[model samples]
Target: MTAVQPKPTPVGETFDSLNPATDEVVGTYAVHTADEVRAAVERARGAALWWEGLGYAGRAERLQRWKGVLTRRLPQLCQAVRDETGKPLRDAQLESVLAIEHISWAAKHARKVLGRQRRSTGLLMANQAATVEYRPLGVVGVIGPWNYPVYTPLGSITYALAAGNAVVFKPSEYTPGVGKWLVDAFAEIVPEQPVLQLITGFGETGGALVGAGVDKIAFTGSTATGKKIMAAAANTLTPVVIEAGGKDPLLVDVDADLDAAADATVWGAFSNSGQTCIGVERAYVHERVYDDFVAKVVEKTKDVRAGSDAAAQYGPVTMPSQLGVIRRHIADAVERGGKALVGGVDSVDDRYAQPTVLVDVPEDAEAVREETFGPTVTIAKVRDMDEAIEKANATKYGLGSTVFSKTRGVELASRLRAGMTSINAPLSFAGIASLPFGGVGESGFGRIHGPEGLREFSRPKAVARQRFTAPITLTSFHRRASADPMVARLVTFLHGKR
Candidate 1:
């Protein structure tokens, strides 16, 4: 199960994608260079014109057809996802379903969200007809992550396409097969042009994409890598929407259903081998029920295993190097006087990490302060919900969080310093199509998945048409001298009191 390093290939050559659970070559993809990336972007620029020409209705029709292709061939896509990322087939299916949901939502709502709409001229310009609309930004470059390869990247790609823009996607080097599947599916429906293209490689390929002059870059990965992407995009001042890493927390209240809270803690912390960016990495439980909650979470996690088998609850870590990080965090927690409630540092093997729950860990421990990105959770006792919220918000990453309380759910959720909080459920906001998804601080900015998401890949254009001559010619230099005083008097009468 150890990591398998690919043999060196010549420049501009191809590389092999390996299965994490078996170190077997799943697929071979090209290492696209800067020139090739630029060529893809250039071709996308032309495709964007035709995509925009389709209009909202026409584009929606084509998108619907593409959705059909994805739906019908979901099993194939799921297999590809599993082969490349080592996620269970069911997990891969879930990821594909969520991605399809986003595609459907974006296609259905793009027109209503971005179409032109009339606006009030206001008292100062009553003679002008004002309107505002969102316009496509031409071409978008998406650098996707390996974990949840299908669901996460589609969040940006689907919305960008629905907004009448062509896209050039660079999936993670580990999961290029899944990316190719998606691009090939889109091409099946819209073969007239390269409206959606695929480019595969490692960091250099993604860097090339950032410098390829695409209208905007949408990236999802580690915060460190996100910073590099932002810095690179700064040179050309290209706008980017980054959905980065997170050390998300889950809080348990004194009044919460201990069983449900424990279930959420186990699932939120360990699901997908805890490779999820928004997965729960820490938990804060009220002291009143801390022992009982921890007991239940331990009981639940005992049966959760990670492997490549269908019966396994989760799969191996998609990226093998992450195993060392997981080991270090667990070891650090244990060394800092934390007690392993379930599994310990030994839980992290060469490929998969068993569910490890640690308690009594100091607040400053690496397990509590950093992103483990593994199937691990650090539970701490908090005196009250206030303390829980404070400890949860202590981290620099403000991504996703969960609050398990019946009566105080919304109130406590509102106080948590995260982008999105689930009152009684784990990661519920992500399933809702209308809610905007993105984080503040290091988790990255610029939303995807709602009306804001539709607007993210487009730019606003305002229009003002003169309906008739105004009674006061203040805008013209030939206006009468008395117009200045008249305008002053009108402004004072309209807004002076306010």
Candidate 2:
């Protein structure tokens, strides 16, 4: 008998997550296969029934317990986030704190936002009683982004759970450890079943989850990947909420406080290594104060550094592949007559990218037009706020924006073509629990926060019942010849003046 060789292990059956700052292996995770993903969806389907059966109060009670667990073990969760994404411990803590707040908001307000409410029956159906309630969709697959892993994913996960739906989360391959930690923490509170389950792997695993017969898919990642996710979800006609890429901008008016605007610009552009989807990637300043604002920004960024130390302002780029894109954008800007007032292309290395401020760059430059997703910003001088608004709204991506103006703050903010705008502040919309967070254009559609977020993971269920016999029965075939003329007259009388 000939000896048979054992079958070779699949290429991506297992993988290790590495810390971007040190390249140290944080943990090893199994690369869940398509079959495994389908199995998870199946389990979630059953869990959804049980989870939904709990109703709003029961679900809120369990979610509150999970919130307590997250609050108590926040430090541990933040450490796990730091290890996987190379963010500072403080940044990790901030992300977790925001996520916990979202949980509390979703739990406390779910019943109010999604519970059944009486609806006014129209004149034609005055004798009927109508009610509407938001019902949870079963088995939501959340494909999360690595940047701000805890805050971003939980923005969808917490709200979905609060709305009484089971979730199957597939975090980025680089941040699987963080995903596992969150799932494990939730399991501690709701041990009866896997209400929130984690599946680890690369793009293939995420693709599998998209096609795993999920009722809905909430994806956060690049615009390119979001398109692919939509294509896959279309196979099953599953609805999706996509929080994709963004090329957000910050505007500085002449009447703005130069010092405060500069500080906001620096923090908005460099914090979290500028991996934020809503990070200020472009700055359009009024010509009257453009030079002064640029100088302030340059000076502010001088002390900022990226490293794996307590004193460093930020950490390394979470994904090594993004370094090349950062380099290309910087180099392209410089070659096209853009001046690097602070760091340049040379500041980017294999791991970390220092803060880079580019000025005199044309509107057509890659740094200005594309989503660089780096610690870099292009400062452009515009004649007025009109020009600034025009330039800020020029991009195909409009996720978030910032406006700094003493007098025209609200006016300018309302004119910007984006989903969320911060007035005299940086990223204020994201922290507010009641405001919806998403974007228009290439930033993708749908929301993940506030009352809209709770509704996004659910479907509207309308109930109509006959309270009494109507004088004219229009819905039925019986005795409807004269009812039609009466209904038309009623509608014309009620709406003709408008």
Best by TM-score: 1
User: TM-score for each prediction?
Assistant: 0.98, 0.97
lDDT of 2 by residue, 94-208 (tens): 9899989999999999999999999999887889899999999988999998999999999999999999999999998888899998999889889998899999888889999
> Considering only N, C-alpha and C atoms within 3 Å, which residue pairs clash in candidate 2?
none
| Residue pairs of candidate 1 with colliding backbone atoms | none
RMSD of each: 1.3, 4.9
* CA error at residue 63 for candidate 1, angstroms: 1.1
Candidate 1 lDDT for residue 177: 91
**Candidate 1 vs. true structure, TM-score:** 0.98
Worst 10 residues of 2 by lDDT: 1-10
Query: After TM-score superposition, what is the CA distance of residue 54 in candidate 2 from its true location, in Å?
Result: 1.1
